[model samples]
Target chain A: MVSLSDVPLTKDRFQTARAAHLWLVLLLVSVSVTSLAVGASGTSLWGAFAKILSGQSLSQMEKVVLWDIRAPRLLLGISVGAALAVAGAVMQGLFRNPLADPGLVGVSAGAGLGAISAIVLGSTLPIGIVALAGNALIPVAAFFGGWLSTIVLYRVATRGGRTSVATMLLAGIALGALAGALSGILVYIADDRQLRDLTFWGLGSLAGATWGKVAVAAPIILLSILGAFTLGRGLNGLALGEVTAHHIGIPVQRMKNLSILVVAAATGAAVAVSGGIGFIGIVVPHLLRLWTGPDHRTLLINAALLGASLLLLADVISRVIIAPAELPIGIVTAVLGAPVFLWILLRRRGMVDL
Target chain B: MLIANDITVQLGHRTILSNVNFNAQPGTVTAIVGPNGSGKTTLLRALSGDVDYSGQVLLNGCDTRQLKSWELAAERAVLPQASTLAFPFTVIEVVRIGLQSGTSGETDSVAMQALNLVGLPHYANRFFQELSGGEQQRVQLARVLAQVWDPVLDGTPRWLLLDEPVASLDIGHQLQIMDIARNFAHAGGGVITVMHDLNLTALYADSVAVLAHGSVLAHDSPMQVMTDAILSKAYECSVKVNTPPPSGFTYLLPHSAGLATVSQDSL
Candidate 1:
């Protein structure tokens, strides 16, 4: 199927395996510094490095910029990017549709509505009341909203007890439309600031990444990400078609459910932290597949790496594009991701499906 | 042992398989043949736990319905009529999936041996989806061959349920598959394959199940089921059978008055 360069390096080819592993590790290693240092703020790379290494209390301005702002935002970008990429890769496996997205599966939209409802209802409740309501209100609403759409989609898509791509896609489309309409109606009743906030959040930004946001996102992202890496074998079995998957003792139904739950929750958590970032879920697995083939073990980890790198780079570009104000991360990804996606598509016209 | 007792399949308001009964002991090939829409794949899918059906399938004295997913997989493996994998995997990688729930699954030597059985050992490293239809079929066979397991307990029996596995292969490959199926049965593994080729059935099938309109019209040896009256009725074609000069199997021919009855293909 491929020439010399196209032939995938096998695991036994220790040199080739080492080369690819080293390259991906290098990519991952390379981006950790970029995430920490590249930003629009006053914390220079040397300053942040010196502050941490020197073990000295920073000036008030430096402390505020580093801890309160840049640190959390960078962490959020990497986490959310990783979450979307992993969720997207999972969805691609779940439905065997390369084009499926975390949002299209209704996870993102449901979580968006849930978090927005919390924000909208927060104004009416006092600070004294907010503490009582916020803890129970936010994640519950998000989980319930996301889970409801997922359950409905699963039922409609699975016919005579088997899940098919055509049915999954159709059901996803129907539920997505219903969620979009309900979200629009919610936005209709909002006040001026709430309206602006909803619009801006829907366009998506990592602007609200505080320590509190990380506190909420960290555990969910970590657990789902771990589960994804562990379940790589089951996902690869599934891509072989359901009968073969079941014949291989894969517990196809259980794997399907696990995939949906893990993806929806991870996507919901990411949406809760960083609003609705679009296109990342739809494209990352595809690019990952191009780079590493469809073996899920490599695809899952590579997805996390490339996704983090892609979004971190997108964040950097967003910051520098407008000197004083940053563009929405969603806009930046679409502008950048679209060209790469189209380039892949155009170059492969009538040549390869991926 | 494999048993399907009065299996009935209903889709929507219509019945697809109506009270079909069949069973097979170890070391036998129970060839299931039927016209299109006669529920061959449906029956095979039911056997592999791919569908919810009424009635019972017992394997090695255990009810299949009660078996866990992994248990059923280890005991009975089914090759559907056609499997076109949507993902990109090397032929070896695809075969390795057959070891999902089996012991000795990680041994590439065993997998390569299985591929060698099907004359595809050299293609083990080739991309599965890159192969032609015929090659892919052989590769899938190798996958199943790698999946041989001890799920029948320390001394229990193993079974293979295949649905039209050689539908795309050429004549020589088809004969090789027939031989392989025969070998599996002769070695005390139950082999049930759905085949459309009557000549192939005559050549290799130890027993044949003629399914017509969701019901078994006949269940007997190929010599009994391939009679001119039943063949003409089931296949809707005129046919003639010719005995070999020595003692080979009968060869089928088109029924025509001008051709000599003894000439198998003179028509």
Candidate 2:
């Protein structure tokens, strides 16, 4: 109901913002399509987009490339990107720590470990069985893993239903490290092909994305993100800090639990699909914070959009930079993101926090 | 009326407040004064039902513990010593928090009125954390005022608990805050505040409770509890009660005494 990042686009005309946001969303979509169409094959960007939308029959190779190759991959990138970003925004609001991301409760490493176990075991089974086991079972395991960490962290930090940001951060760091170690152990046990698969997967790419894969990740991402949007009001209440939140009857514990679940499910799903892409959650919210203030309504939704755009743009660059030989989107994001972080740091030099 | 009964609080196995009992009529400004770690804040927390306590608190003849959180919230508001806002809420948004205790009915209007009462309506769109400390205190007061100013609960008034809210304010804002507290009490609200300024306590308190070592040392009218002996012993310093010319109203002024005995009767 209340969003901590609810900076109404116009301090006056709040309702007008949806139209603008839609326009921006559409503009980004066009950009995404253009990036995909103008690939190494040198297809005309508008002709490819027109052909894709108009139901014009493609040649066998074109059909395979467009529908099979680019389409599902783009959707997966967009959806997972949005999920990771929104999850990040919510995490920052809940913890009151700007540096915190969706993976704070070991979600990333947990997901990575779950995915790795699926890969190692999948090698022993049929390819379909392994793909099913890895894609379906891994996210569920990752979800529970994230949920367990959140509960433990909540208990360690909370007294009388009020959670401490500092304690949660410390707990998150410890848990994340532990999960990372387990991921390492899992990686160490893989065979040659398994190791190759894990290596490239660990680096994170959209190459494996099919519509079926998008379908695997989409429901969890969509539902959790929508749920988080509903918490815009509650998140704003949370930003007031716990005592006042309780004073205003926010049901602080319940809100924290709900936020954790949403964060876990959303981040878990993203990690299950995207591998351990770091800092989308951290950077998106930080940038949005500067633009939208601390209100979550604006912050949450903007983070989702900006993250989609950022990931789409990142994926496009990853695809085009190496031509047919693509770089992982994860590597590209970190390469691009670190410089922005540095710029913010330098601009605010001597100021305590950016 | 607001009543704090048999409230006992322990922290890390040591009793911070033990069996504290007190009551104040509606429309009265009650001041709680004590030395450091005397459990004044703990008592306020207990009364506000912000933490666990051994006993019950009653507001307007209803048990605070038994009332649903939303039910209890409509009848009282507490402003702690420090409220941290991590979000960049505008002044209006900060005050709007007080309105959530009840229906959102006419709250924007009332919030504006509360801000206007604090002489801050012009800053409605300004960021809350950007304001000066005094201004922030005023905005916080405005928010609490909106909470207690309920139309449906008009017949029976609510309570206000302020925990040293004026500590960071300057002399002008301090007096302004004291005036606001006095006004709120005079308007049939039960008001309790912990204050260190003896002069302020004398100025606004209808009844004063002095706590020492987590116990009530004295509870009575200002003149009764604020004698030279109690003042000197409470602060462990020599003090002179000053009554300035023209008004003849008394104020507390600390003094240094070296190996000499003095009497109030001499003054």
What is the lDDT for A300 in model 1?
84
lDDT (tens digit, per residue) of candidate 1 on A1-354? 223344344553222333555676677656766756666664676785687799976777777777787778777788888889999999888777676787876767777777677767767767887776564455556656776777778888886567776787777777878888887787878889988877777878887778877777878888888888876878878777877888878888778878888887788888877777877886888876666677776788877777877787787778778956889888999898788778767865664434
In terms of docking quality, how is candidate 2 classified?
acceptable
Please give the CA lDDT of all the candidate structures: 0.76, 0.76
lDDT string, candidate 2, A1-354, tens digits? 223244233363222334446755886687677656845565564665577699885567666667776778778888878888898889878877665686666667666766777777655667777666655665566556666666677788787667777777787788889878887887788788888988887888777787777888888889999888877767777777778776665667778888988888888788777777766887877776666566676678877888888888888898899897888888998898888867766765664333
Residue A38's lDDT within candidate 1 is: 61
- The alpha-carbon RMSD values of the candidates against the true structure, listed in the order shown, are 4.0, 4.8
Cα lDDT tens digits, model 1, B83-162, are: 86766677877877777532243566677677778887667667787899899988888888677633234566677888
